[model samples]
Target: MQRIHWFSTLLLGFAAASSAQQAAQPAPAEAAPLSAPVGTDPVVTQPAAAVEAVTNVVDRAADAAEPAAPAEAAEAPGQAPVQAVVPGTPAAATAAVAGSTAPREGKIPALDSRLFPRYDSLQPKVAFWTKVFGQYSENQSAIHSSTYPNKVFEVLDFRADAMRLDKLALARLKNDEETRAKARYNRLLEEVDRLRDSPQQLNEEQRRVWQLYADVPGERRFRDAVGTLRAQRGLKERTALALETSGKYMPAMESIFRSYGLPVQLTRLPLVESSFNVEAYSKVGAAGLWQFMPSSAKIYMRLNEVVDDRRDPWTSTDAAARHLRDDYNALGAWPLALTAYNHGRGGIARGLQKVNGNTLPDLIARYDAKSFGFASQNFYAEFLAASDVEREWKTHFGEQLQRNAPLRYDTVETKHYVPYETLRRLCDADDEVFRKLNPAYRPEVIEGKLYVPPGHVIRIPAGHASAFNVGYAKLGSSERFDSQRSFFLLHKVAKGESLGKIAKQYGTSVASIKSASGLKNDSVRIGQLLKVPPREERRPGPVIVAVGESKPSLTRAETAAVEAERREQARPAARSKPKAPRTHKVRSGQTLSSIAKQYKVSVNSLRDANGIDGSHLAVGQKLRIPAS
Candidate 1:
C-alpha cells in the first residue's frame, strides 16, 4: 500500500510539470497564426493576439507560482526552492526558439558582420567568414576591402591554403612560370656580371699592347698594315707602299719602347696614326705618322716649316714612345697609359683621382667620365678584336702578300732647295721611292743650307752613297734668290683716288694701270691694287720721232685709237693662230712653273696643256693633252 502511495505521488508531480510546460508553449493553432505572411499588417494580426494571450496566461501562472514557491520555501525552511526545480528554464527556451525560427541572428555567420561592417572605423572589424578562413583569408579581405561589397565569393588570399590547392592542381603551370622568372633574373645578373668583369678581362700590359691596334677605325686598317708584310692585291697596295717607306723607322721605334721596357707592339701605333704617311696632315693641323697636333708635336718632336722633325718617322716614333713611357711611369699601369694616350695624361690622372684609387671598372661605375664615348670607350675592345682577326687573316693569306725588300737608308744634311728629283737621281732611287720616303718636303725642296736641321734626317736608298757624293760634287754651290723680287709691284688705290693716283704711286701711266687691272670704262674698285710688271730703266732725255712716226701718244684720244688698233690687230691674230698642241711628259724636278718657263709659256698654259688636275705631281708621269 505504501509503494502505491509513493508511485501515485510521483505521477501527480510529473502531471503538474507536464501541464506547466504545455501552458508555456504556444498551441499549434496559435503558432500557425505567428507564421502569417511576412508583409501582412502587424496591428491587425489575429496570430500575434493569440500568442500574446497564451504568453500572458503563462506569465501570470509563473508570477503566482514564484510568490507561492517563496512562501512555501519560507515555511519549509531547509528544503530547496520550487523555482530552482528548472534552472535557466524560460530564458534558455526563449533563446533557442529565437535562434531556430527567426531570421538567423547573423546571416552567413562566417562572413556577415565584420567583412561588411555596419559602420566605418579606423580599425576594420574581424569579419565572420574571414575568421573561419583564418589569417590568410583575413589578409585577402584586407587587400580588397572597401566601402562597397561586391563579388564576395571571389576573395581568396594569394598566400592561402586555397592558392596552395590550385598550385597542386596545376603543377606544370606553376613550375613553368617559376622557371621562366628565374631564368630571366639569372640572365640579367649574368649580363651585369659581364659588364662588371670587363675591366679585368684584360691586364694592364695586355690593354697597353692591344691599344696600338685596337684604336683603329676598322679591322681592315690593321689588316692593311699586315697585308704590307706580305704582298697582297686589292686596297693594300698603298698600305704596302706606306709600310715599305715607313717600316725603316720601326726598328728605331722598337728600340725606344724596349728602352723603356714597354711592349714591342707599340711599333704598330704609327700605322693607325698616320697611315705611315710622314707628311700626313690632319684637319686639326696634326702632322706626321704620329699625327701630333702642333702644340703636342712641339712638346715631343721638333717642328718648323724648314725642318719638321715630326715628319721624320724615326724621330717622331722615338718621341711618342718616350711620351708613352713617361705616362706609363707616372700612372704605373699600361691601361691607364693607353687611356692617357686618347685623353691626355693629366685627364687620366684626374679621372684616377676622382675614382679614389679604384680599378678601371670601379672608376667607370662611380664616375661620369665623358671620354668613354662610342669610339673611345670601346677603343680597347676594338683593338683586341681587330688584332685577333688580323693575325688569323695573315696566317691564312700570307702567300698573297708582296715581299718588298726591307727599306735601308742613309741620312744627309741639306740646307738648300735641292729638288727631290735631283736627290732621287743622285741617290739612284726611283722617283716614286724618293717621294714616298721624303714626304715632308713641300715643292720637293728642303730649304736652307744646314745638315738637314739639327735633328732633320734624310733617307737615301740602299747602295747609293758613293753615287750621291759624285752627283753632289757635280752640282754647283747652292744659290739664294729673293722670292719677293719675283713678285710684280701692286699699287693700292687710295680712297677718293683715281687710277691716275695709282699709276703715279706705281710709276706707270693711268692707261697702263687700267689695261693691266682690266678696268672697264676706266672705272675701278676703291682700294684696288693694280699689278705692274717691272719695266726697263729709263734715262732722262727729250723724245725723238723718226720718219713715219705714229707709235701712239699718252693722250686719251691717242690711247683710245691705239687700243682700237690693237683690238683690230688681235682679231686677225686670234683667227690665224692654230690651237696649241697638248700633252707632255713630267720631267725630273719639273714643277708647273719651271715647265712653263722651260717652254717659254705661262703656268696656266702648262696646266691646260697637260690637263694637270692639281698642283701635286708625280715624277716620270705622263699627262693628258689640254687644248691651250
Candidate 2:
C-alpha cells in the first residue's frame, strides 16, 4: 500500500503539473484559480520544489473531487468570465505556492495568535492567569515600599534586613557623635561657670560685687564672699602704698563721715576712686583722689586756683559723705544712694520708675543706665562686694595686714598771706609733710586771711612752734621787705634796649632778666614783660677796691664783670678766711661815724670798734673793729 500510494502520488503530481502548465499558457478565460476561501485553514507555503509538487498533487486531487464547470464558448471581444477552484484545492494550491509568500521587500512577521490574539479571540483562562501573577507582584512590591516601590511590607522588610547587616557599627557611630557633642557642651558650660563665679578675675572693686551677686546661688554665697575677702586682702600692699602717699588726711575723712552718721568705712572710698592719688585726673577731667568732675567739685567741694579741696582727701571725703548722707535721706536706701552718686539722683529716680516699680534688679534690667559705661549697672554691687571683702579680710587677718597709720597734726589760723616757702622754712617741715597736713591748700600758700579750713591741721615739728609763730608774726608785720619784690614788676623793653640796659634800669643783671623771663635767644619783643631786680643799694657797688683806697673809674662792662665776680665770691668759700682785728678811737667833736669813715669802716664795725652801741657813742673811747 505504501508503494502504490507513492506511485499514485507521483502520477497525480505529474498530472496536476500538466494542468497548471496548460492553464498558464493562455488558458480559456474561465479556467483561472479562485481566491482562497475565508474561514478555511490557511496554509504556509514553502519554496522547495518537492514540497510544491506534493502540495500541487494534493490540490489536484481535491480539484478532481469537485465538479468541473462546462467550457464557455468564445465571448464577445470585451467580455471576461470568472473561473472557480474547489474549496480544498485553493488551500492546497496556496500550500504549494512559491519559495516564500512573504513579501520579498516589505512584510511584518506574523504574531502568534495563540499567545496574544485579537480581542474577540482571546482565551479567558490565559488572561485570568496573567492578572493573578500581576497582582502577586504588586503585593510583593508594596511589602518592600521602604526600599522598593508598590508593596506594603517590602519596605519594612528591606529596612530590617539592612539594619541587621551593620546594627552595631551604626549604634557606635551615633554614640560617639553624642559623646562628642556632650563634651563640647560641658566645656562651654565650664567656661561660663568660671566667668560667672570667679571673683579673683575682677581687678576693680566695682566689678567684684556685680560678679558676686550675678545669679550666684544662696548656698554658695558664703564661699564666694570668703573668696572675695582673701582676694581683697591680697591687694593690701598695693592699697597701703597708694593710701600712704595720698590718704594722709583719712583721719579727718573719718571724722567727717562720723559727723554725718555715715559709715566710717567710706574713708577707704578713695581706694576705688583714684587708688588714693591726689592728682589723679580722669579722661573726662574729673580730678583728685575723690575723682570729682569739675562741675560737681565746684558745687560740693571747694575749687579755685588757690585751692582745690577736691584734691584734699579729708575735705572731699567730708563733701562726699555729706552728699551721700543727703542722698540716703532722700532715697532711704544705701544702694540707691550710691547709684545716685554715679548717675545723679534724678537719673536713678527715673531709672527706678522705669522698672514698673522701684526695684533695683528690675531697674538694672530695664533702664538704660549709662553712667559708668555698660559695666556701670553693676557699680554699686562692686562697691558692696569690695566692702564685704575688706571687712572679712580685716577681721580674719587682723594686724597681719599693715594697718594705715593715723595722721597727726595741729591747726593754726592766720589772717594774713603767708608764703608756702616761709611756712615750710619756719616750721622746719618737709614739703611732703606739710602738704600731708595741709592738703586743702592747693598751692600750699594761704592767701589773705584763709581760715585754714577744717581739714588743714598744720603739722608743727618738735620745738618749731615758737619759730613758726615768730615767722608768722613777721608775715603780718608790714616792715618786712620782699627780696623778690623788685623781680615781681613787669617791664617792657624798648626797641633799642638790650637786656643789659633793661636789667641796669631795674638794678638787675642781663642774665637774671633773661632767666626770669625765660628768653632763650636773648631776643625781647618791644612789649614783652620782663622781670628785674629792685633798686636796693646796687649790691653795694661791688666793694670797689678797699674802703681806704680811691675808687677807680670803670667801663660799664668792667664794672658789671667786677660786680658779677664779687657776687660770685661773696658766697661763703668751702674753707673759712682768717679774720684781722684793728683798733679805732672816737675823736673830740668827731663822730664815731667820721672816725669809722676815715678808716672805711662799717657802722657795725664801729659798734665793735669802740664797744659802743650804734645807737649811742662816747667821745674819746677806744674800740676794736674787724677789718675786711
Candidate 3:
C-alpha cells in the first residue's frame, strides 16, 4: 500500500511541474494529475547475458572486526566506510568521532561546492526539500510556485485513505479537491495581481504572500510569479522510516561506493527513490533498492528469466556504483551526474545545451523544457536534503531512535549450474531464510524450475561456509547439471489454440505467458513462436554423500493435470462480465489522433482509455481501446 502511494506521489510530482504553468496555456480537459504518467527512461535492448563467470562478491564476513563510528559508520564487518563532506563545511567542524579506515590516495571529492555548488540563491529551494524530508507527511502537500519554491501559499491535508479509496470515490474526492484548489488559486491570483498594481493595499493573508517576494529586486516580481504556482506532496513519514531502513544496507552500500571510488553519500539516493523499499516496483518497471529500470539495469547487471539483480540490494548496489561511475565520468560533476541519473544523460546534456549553462542551479533556473520538469529539477536538492537529514539524524528523528541492524551474510560462488533444491540441500537452508539471503532469484528459480546459473553468488547464513564446502564436494555430477537449462521452451502458436489452453497445459499462469512474450493480450497469431514456461518436473536430489559418490540421478515422474475449474481460474473469469477489448500497441508514426481516427473514437476517449493526458506516445507502447 505504501509503495502504491509512493508511485502515485511520483506521478503527482510530474503533474505538478506543468500544473503551475497551466494559466499560460490551454489545460487538458480533465486537468487531473493522473493525466501525466512518469514514463521509464529510454528503453535499451537488453543483452543476452550481463555477467560472466566472476562476481564482485567473494569477500567473507569478519563477524566482529568493526564497530560503530561517526565517520565511517562501519557497524559491521566486511562493511567499508566513507563519509561525504558537505560542501563549505569543514570535515572537522561538522562532525566526526574518529576514523578506522585510512583514506585512499586521490579519493573523489565529496559533493563539494565546486562540483555540486549550493548557491545562496537556491537555499530556499534546498530548505523546501529539507522540509519535504523532515516536516511534511504523505497526506499533506504544500502549494507553492514552481518558479519560486519558497512562495508556499498553503499546505493541504488530505484524508489518510484518500488514495486507498475506490476508483469512483477517489475520482469524486479528487474532483472536489480540484474545485477547492481552483477557488483558492483564483483568490491568490486576485491578491497577487492587486499587489502588482497597488503594492500597499494588502490583507493579512495577501501580505504574507506579498512578503514572500520581499527579496526580489524587480517591480514585476509579483506579476512574474503569478502563473508559477504548484503543489508538492510530502514524504516526511516515509523518509523517516527510510532513515531506519537505510541502516540495514548502508554499511555494505557505502563500501560498494567506496570500492568504485565514489562518495558514500550516494547511498541516500534510495531515500528519494524507493524510500528504502527493496521490494518496490514502479508502474514503469523500475525495481529494487536503487530502482533501476530494466532497460538500463540490464546493461550493467544480469536480469534473466530466473533472476532480476535489481531486487537484490548488494548486487544492485554494485550495479549502481558502476552506473554512477560511468555517469560521473561522462558528466564530470555529482550534481549533473545525479540529475542525469534521473532525467537521463541525453536529457541533461540537452538541457545544458538549451540553457547554455554548465551548473545545475543555472539549468534549474533557466531550463524551460517540458521534459525537464519538477522531478528532474528537484533531484539534486532532494539528495542534499536527504544527506543532511541523515547527518543531523538526532536533530530530526531523535537520538533515541533505533536503526535496523546491518545485513550480515557471506556470499559464495557456485561450482556449476544447479537447482534450487540442490543448493538448499547443500547449505541446509530453511526456505524462508534462503529467500531472505538471496532475494535476486525469481519465482521460477525459487519453485525449482529455473536453473541457478554457474558461478552465481548465493548468500548463506553466517558460519555455514565450511559446511557448504563439504556438502558440495560430496555431490555427484549427475545431481548437478553441467549447464543451466533455459527457463522457457519455444512453442509455435497453432490455429485454435488460446493462451489459456497453452498456459493450463503447461501448469503456468496466463499472466506469465503474456509477460514472457511481451503480449498485450491473450490473442496470438498462428506460427508466432512464444516463450512458454516448461512443464513442472521433479527436482534433482543428492545422489552421493557421506563416503559415497558418483551415484546415478533419480528418475522423474509425470505430473498430474490440474482441474478444469482450476485452469479456468488462471485466466480471468469470463463468466463474471465481458472481457476488455483488445488493446492497441503504438507502432511507429502513430498518434492519438491517427489511432483515434483508425478506431473511430474521439481522441479524448483514446487518452481516457490509456489514462494518459498528453499526446506523447512511445513506439511499441500499449494502450487500451475503450468500448466505442
- What's the TM-score of each model vs. the native? 0.36, 0.37, 0.59
Model 3 residue 32 distance off true place after TM-score fit, in angstroms: 44
Number of colliding residue pairs in each model:
17, 19, 0
Q: Write the per-residue lDDT of candidate 1 for residues 1-628, one digit (tens) a residue.
A: 0011122222322233343333223223212111112221101111111110011011111111000011111110111111101111233323332332121221101112221112221011112111211222211221111111110111222233335456455444433433443343234334433433364575443332233333334434322332111100111223333333432344344444555566655554553345455556654455677656555554554444334556656556665776666667677765555445544666556776987963444444455665443223322322222222222223322434321222334444333334445566676766556655565554314332222211123456534556665675577644211111122456676678777676655445665454445555567677777665333222111111110111201222223434565677687554466766656688788786666566565554344344343567888877544343
lDDT of 3 by residue, 1-628 (tens): 1212222232233333343233123222322110111212111111222211110001111110111111211111111111111111122211110110111111211344454566555555666777777777655666666766655666666655565787578546644664566367557666776666676776755656566666566877766766566557676667666765655556456655665677776877887777777777765567887877765665565566667788887678777776777677766788888877777776777778898988888788898877677667777877776765655555566655444544444445565567887877777777766776678888888887767755455666555667777787787876665434545668898899989988866656686677666677778989999876544221211110100101211111101112333455597745567766978999999988788888877564565456453579999999877677
Q: Please give, for residues 1-628, the per-residue lDDT of candidate 2 as tens digits.
A: 0011122222222243343333123212222121121222221111122110011011111111111111221111110111111111332222222211111111212222232122211122112111112122111111111100111111101223334547566445434433443343234334444555564664443232333234335544423332111000013333434423332344345445555666655555565555566666655555676666665554454464346667665556655775676666666666566656655666666667766755455566577544323223433543433333333333323334432333333333333334556566667777666665456675424432222321122444333455666676665444222111112457877789888778766545675555445567677778777765323221111111111112212223334445666777797767767766667666668765566677776544444323332345567666666574
C-alpha lDDT score of every prediction, in listed order: 0.38, 0.40, 0.58
Most lDDT-accurate candidate: 3
| Model 3: per-residue Cα lDDT at residue 459 | 69
Which RMSD does model 1 reach against the true structure? 51.4
Lowest summed-lDDT stretch of 10 residues in model 1?
65-74
Name the TM-score of candidate 1.
0.36
lDDT of 3 at 133: 79
